[model samples]
Structures are given as C-alpha cells and as structure tokens.
Target: MSPRPFDHVVGKNLTSVKFPVVAGLPGPEGLKTHLRGHLLRMSNVGALRVLVTGATGYIGGRLVPRLLEAGHQVRVLVRDPAKIRSVPWADGVEIARGDLTDAASLREPFRDIDVVYYLVHSMNSDGDFEEAERRSAENVASAARDAAVGRIVYLGGLHEHSDRLSTHLRSRTQVGEILIDSGVPTMVLQAGVVIGAGSASFEMIRHLTNRLPVMTTPRWVNNHIQPIAVGDVLHYLAAAATAATSESRTYDIGGPDVLRYGEMMQIYAEVAGLARRRILVLPVLTPKLAGMWIGLVTPVPLSIGRALIESLSTDAVAYEHDIDAIIAAPSGGLTPYRDAVALALRNAENTEAGWDGAAADPLPTDPAWTGEIVYTESRDAVVRADPQRVWEALLHWSSRHGHWTVENKQEPTLLELHGPGRARLQWRIESVTPARTRLHQHASYIPKGLPGQLYWLGLKPLHRIGLRRAMQSVIKESEGRR
Candidate 1:
C-alpha cells in the first residue's frame, strides 16, 4: 500500500478491526473509505441517496456503514421500526417502515431514491419460502420501476446455470431475473459462501468444522465451491452503486480460491489450530439426514442447514469474472479462501462486539454436549449495587489478587480472566430488573490428558474457594461504594 493510504491506517489496530484483510487492505481501505465517507457526509455534497432493505441482516448491517462512509445518503426500509433502534448507525440513516412483500408499502420508501439495494430475502421461513422470496423480489422490482429508481443492486447466491439448481439457488436466480426485467437498471452480484463472522454460510462451516472431529458426511462435500470474503462482497456492493454500467445485468463475484465443500471444513480447522478432522463420505446420506445431523452437532438451525446443504449439493464455482470490468479488485486482491478464514478467526477476538466466535471452543448457543467433554462450574448472585460499581469492585479484587490478568473486557457487562492453557474464568454482569443487578461467574477447563486432568482435579477445590472469596470481596466493595 502507498504511504498516503497506509497513513490513514493509524489510530486503529488493523488486525482486530471488524473487517480483517483480503489478506489488511480491507482494514486500511476500510479506514480510508471511512475518512472519505465522513468528509462527504459532513459536506453533504455529491452523495448518492439510497434505500436499503435487510439493514438488520449480516451483510446489510455491515454495508450500511460502508455506504455512509462512501458519503452516500442511506435510508433503510424495515417491516418493524424497533428492529433497528439500537444499532450504532441507526441515527445516521433514514428508517422507513415497509414490507417488501407488500408492494404498496415499498412505494413510499422507493420514491426519491437514486439507488435501491435489495438485500432482504425470506430464508428458511415457516411458509412457502420460495413464493415469499419471489413475491418480495417482484414487489421490489415493480416499486423501483414505478418510482423510476436509477439503479437496483441485489446480492444473490452464485450457482451453475442449470435447471437442476437447488431450491435456494433457483429462488435466488429467479429473484435476479425478476429485477432485471423490471424496466429498471439492476446489477445482480451473485456470490458463493461469504466467509465472515455472523454470516450464515460461514457460521455453518465454522460450527461443523470446529465441533466435529469426524463427520459422516453427505456426497455434496465433494462439490466445488467458491467462497468470498464479506468485505469483498461489501466492496462490490458499494461499487455497484457508483459504477456507470451500460445496462441491467447479473455478474458472478467470488474470491480467488475454489475448493470442495469438505475441503473448506478442513481448511477452517487448519486456520483455527485444530486437529485435522476425519471424514467418511457415505453415498447413503441424503440432505435431510445430513441437515438433521448438522442440527444435532452444530449450532446452525435445521432449516438453514438443509437449504445450505442443498445448495452445496452442486458445484458453485464462479463461471466468469466479468465483474472485474466494473469494479477493480481490492487494493491487495480478493481475500483468498485461507486468508478469508483467517480474517474471520482474527475478527473473533472481539466477541464483545456481537461476534459469535469459538466454534471450535465452546458457545452459549451450541447444542449441549456436541463436542468434547468440557467441565464447567458457574456461580451467580444478585447484587444490590449497579453494574459499574460491581465492575469497579471486581477490578479492585483483581488488582489485589495474584496470577490472573484481564484477558478481555466489555466494561460493566463482562470481564474475562485468562488463566494458563485453556482454563478460563468469566464474570458476567447483567441487570436483573430496575436497581437490581445479577453477577454470574463461570469457570471452564478443557484438560489435555492425564496430567492436565490431574491439574484440574487438584485445582478444583482451590478454584471454588478462590471464586467464593473473589465474589465476596467484590460484593463487599460494590455495596460499600457511594
């Protein structure tokens, strides 16, 4: 990177930034983008006024801020207004309450929009998801056309152009066709599995690879897939808004590496520092059976697992690289599969910022007893003081204590203590009700072998005593504070 661009990388840890590198152009580029967008937002000059659906979803949530940094005027449309009330960027954009399935509801939001970003989709819903997806896309198309919207940018899934496409990919492709025929200029950037924290496709891969040491997998594990980084997807989506293209079209976008589905899992294991997983591909396993197995073993929900598995049943490698013409590649390049997974893992260090990490470790959401046997002990108490007071009290206790260091903290909410080798102590503070707070302390240890097991056994009683004393001291200090 040039010195001018690298200079913009100051005041931020490039590694821990939300978007890890397409191998750190994402971080520095992200910073540079933010600087430019901030200036544009301040001047209110030459900004693209756009409306985005799915603002609360994984991609939309990340994209909204990027659009803002690009100095674009963003308006988010949602069925429920409260869904976006607490987001960091909520105050920065206009929020319109409307249902995409209801064409009448979309007309108002679609009006006066230079670009319409159709990022919403009905995935794994209770009703007919395909019909819902189609109707929603149709409504968006008609509304954009009637409102004379300048551009339509839709993020769809990549798949081989075949009648045999799975239900999920077929619906995605159909939605693209509907938008392209809407008499409005649309650019459908179809991407394969997007690798990032909080992405559904990536989450499925993370959980499955982390938890299962061995998999009795489906035949689709052999299917070729091209996975794109979330940053790259956002990059293309942002560019799609500005590119002065000739006509409405669909373009396939992906990372530099393409590999089989099972290969993705093993690569994730390598990135995550886990033992290579064992696998036995059986022809007898169907998508339904495998999905059920995934649901049982991993944190991914059954409906989504089934849909994702079905999509993976066929090769999803990008058929072309036509998108290179409109938007130049990232400064470094697109994040390769290994680098993307590394970025995802690196981003996991900030679990306080709503990143669901520790797929190979332990998760609060994963099914109980899914992976290796982990021993944990938890203690909870209601405190009379507030969270901040309790945190201060805990800090005081830690300062007086020995052999413990602050591993990570979320201020008055969570404080983590890092111990030697896989032994962890977590203190979670929550508001039970008005003027009442609950402080929960949890300890977990994953023993390696006989000696490790003996170490845990030896520390078991000492651990209990230490936790009780720490809780007592913190509680005393908290209630004592004014």
Candidate 2:
C-alpha cells in the first residue's frame, strides 16, 4: 500500500510531455499539433469527475489507483461494496452500491460524472452470461445517455468479426457497439491476453507451468496472439481519457511481439526459471476436452478455460497503430512479450499476503448434524517478505526431516503437505503487494464414527494453538530472512 513510483505522473502538466508517433503516422509537427488540441480540450474541462464500473474486477481494481493518482475525482459503483473493502485505495474514492442490470440503481453514480469506465461483464455469472452481458450493456448505455456523461471508455476482447466468433468475443463486441451508439463519445480499447499477477490468464499460466513438466495441447495452441502487458493496457486506458476525440472510436491495442499460445507458455516457463516443458500438440483434443483438462489440472474454472480456449482458435493481432499517435508509449515504449512475462513474474515474486481476506469454511453443509463430522482449521499471517520468499520458507518447513511429525519419528504422521493448486491440505502463498506476502495454512479432516468424532473434539484446542503458532513461526522466519 505504499506510494507507487508512478504517482508523479498524475497532476503533471500534460503539455510538457512528449508522445511518440508511430511510423507511417503523423510526424513530430503533426504530433505537436494534435497534442496542442488535446491539451486545449483537457484544459477547458479542468479536472474530470470519473465514475468507474466493475471496480472490483482485475483491470478496474488496478485502474482506480491510476485515475486517482492522476488527480481525477473518482467514484466506484459496485453491487457489493464489501468486495472492494480491502483494496488499498478503497478509502480514497466514493463508493455507491448498484448493479448494472438494475437501471434504477445506476442513476446516482452516473450523476455529475464526466467520464464512465464500463468495465463490467458477465463472463463468470451463472446461467447465460451472453444475454446477461447484453442486458447490462444496454442498461449502462441508457443510463450514460440519461446522465449526460461526456465520454465512456471500455476495454473489450480483440477478435475478428465472423459467424464463427466465440460467444465471449461476440458478447464483448456487442457491448462495445451498444456503448458507441449511446450518443455519448465512447472509446473502446480492444486487447487480448493481459499479462499480470493475480489476472486469471496469468494465474492459469503460472499454475500450469509450475505444476506440469509436460503438457498435452489442442490445435488452437498454434493460433497467434498479441498479448499486451497490463501495465501498457493501464497506460492506454488512462491516456484515452485526455485524448482529443469528438466521436466514438475503437483502437486495437497490443504488445510489440506476436506469438502463438504454445510459445507464450514456453516463454513464461523460461522467465519463471522453470525447466522447458515438453508439449504435444494433439489435433484430437477438442476445446471442450481441453477446458476439462485445464480445470482438472489448474485452478482455472472450466467455463473460463473454455472461453479462453475458444478465443485462442483465432488470431488476435492488432491491425492498427493509431493508439500510439494518441497516447505515447511508456518511458521504455511497449514492453516486449518476454519482458512482460518477466515483469509479471517479478510482481508475483514480490506479492504480499492478507489481500485475500479470510479463508472460507471448508466444510459442506450438514443441516441435521448426521453423517460424518467435518472440521477445518486455518491460520493466515502477513509476512514482510514477498510471496516467493514465503513460499520458499514453507517449502523448507515441508522438507524438514521430521519437523511436521509427532515425537519426530514414526514416519511423521501428524500432517501432510499437498498442492500448488487446490489440494485438501495445503499452504498457499498469495500476493498482496510487491513487498508483502500472505501465507495461508489450511487443514481439513472428516471424522467417521463416534470414536473419530470424540478424538477430533478432544484435540480441537491443541489444533488451534498449533496452527496459530506454526503461522507465527513462518512469519518470524520469513522476517528474519528479509
């Protein structure tokens, strides 16, 4: 939660900044003219009152801090404010409770807002998400029109328009069209495969690479993708707000390098310092089967895996470079694909703990207290070191000769360690920040028969104390290493 290095970029004089123009686009003089006009438009408006939807989502969660640092008055609309309560920037902005499907709830949040960032989507919702997305977009467009919002900025999937378009891509395209036609100037930045820590795509890649030394593939793995770094995407989203444009426009945003999905996995492995994985590209594996396999092997849900697999069947490379003419590249220009992976890995390594809040009860519902009695005990600690350090410390604990056993002998039967994924007994290191790590230790057991139940009850107090002390030991050891 400490101040980010990019805080200086906010509230700075835009006119003094120099933006790079892509080849075949405007030259330096033309770039100067465009900047003059853009700055003039920005000056006339002064500071903008921005309302951000999907503030609980990955991109929206990161975007809020950037907007606030840029000196904009920010407000967030969410169906459940508790979802964002633990965010480092939560206390700095206005919070309004509302759902996109309910148009009535949108009025107050939309009021007095100059720009609206529509980051909401129904990809993970139950039932038909496509229909849900359509309804949500229509409601948002209507509400934006009613609120007299000057502009709307949206991030959507990058894909070619075709009868064969995947449902997820089609839904994203439909939402963009709806926003554009709302009579409010809307800027849509279409991108594919945003690489960053805590992102679904990145997490899938991380888990798959770390756990599997070999992987079976689908034919879609050969399809080309132009993955953009989350940092670059954030840069574009933040800059689009100030670009001088009178009409709605769509820009294709991507990184400098284009590679196939399989190549992406290889590069990630290389960056993460894992051994090169052997991948067999089997044409027989259908998207459905691939999704099921991904779900079973990694933490990614089948639905999300299917969507990602479907999108990988088509090329997502950008055909336009107009975004460069508008917003300048970051200080070092667009991050290369390998560099982006390395940065994401670095972020993962430095990830802090405590951001996930508390672990959910692992037991299933037992209304009548019949059948086997199940119980779970969890201990969480925030360590000063990064997740990588915490993970290494835990690995050391697990590898000790007879540490986790009773009496330090008899084959160490006290507890077992399992996972890099969703194993029953596991220690997970989740990233909260660049310098902090959250260590979550969990143990679950189901007692069968009366004797087993009595045994668990008898040892419950000791179990609690042992788990808490173990977590404290981890924290102390990790801090010492730091």
Name the candidate that leads on lDDT.
1
Identify the leading candidate in terms of TM-score. 1
Per-model C-alpha RMSD = 11.8, 13.5
Instruction: Give the poorly placed runs of model 2, Cα more than 4 Å off.
Output: 1-45, 347-351, 354-482
Q: How far out, in Å, is residue 428 in model 1?
A: 8.7
- The local distance difference test score of each candidate is 0.76, 0.70
Question: Taking the tens digit of each residue's C-alpha lDDT, what string does model 1 give over 36-64?
Answer: 43323322336778899988777787788
Backbone clashes under 3 angstroms, per model: 2, 6
Question: Model 2, range 1-482, lDDT digits (tens) per residue?
Answer: 22221123335654564444334335555544533443344445556778999887777877887898888889999888887676778888999999998989999888877788999765563688888888989888877766656678999988875677877888899999988876566899999888766566666676677657788988877888899888898888887766665457788999999898888888988886667878888999988798889888766777777777777778888988887766778778888989877766552311123332211111111112211124678777778987666666665666662434321111211234532221235466777888887777777654432344466689899968876776776787777743
Query: Which pairs of residues collide in candidate 2?
Result: 352-432, 352-433, 352-436, 352-437, 353-437, 353-438
Ten-residue region with minimum lDDT total, candidate 1: 1-10
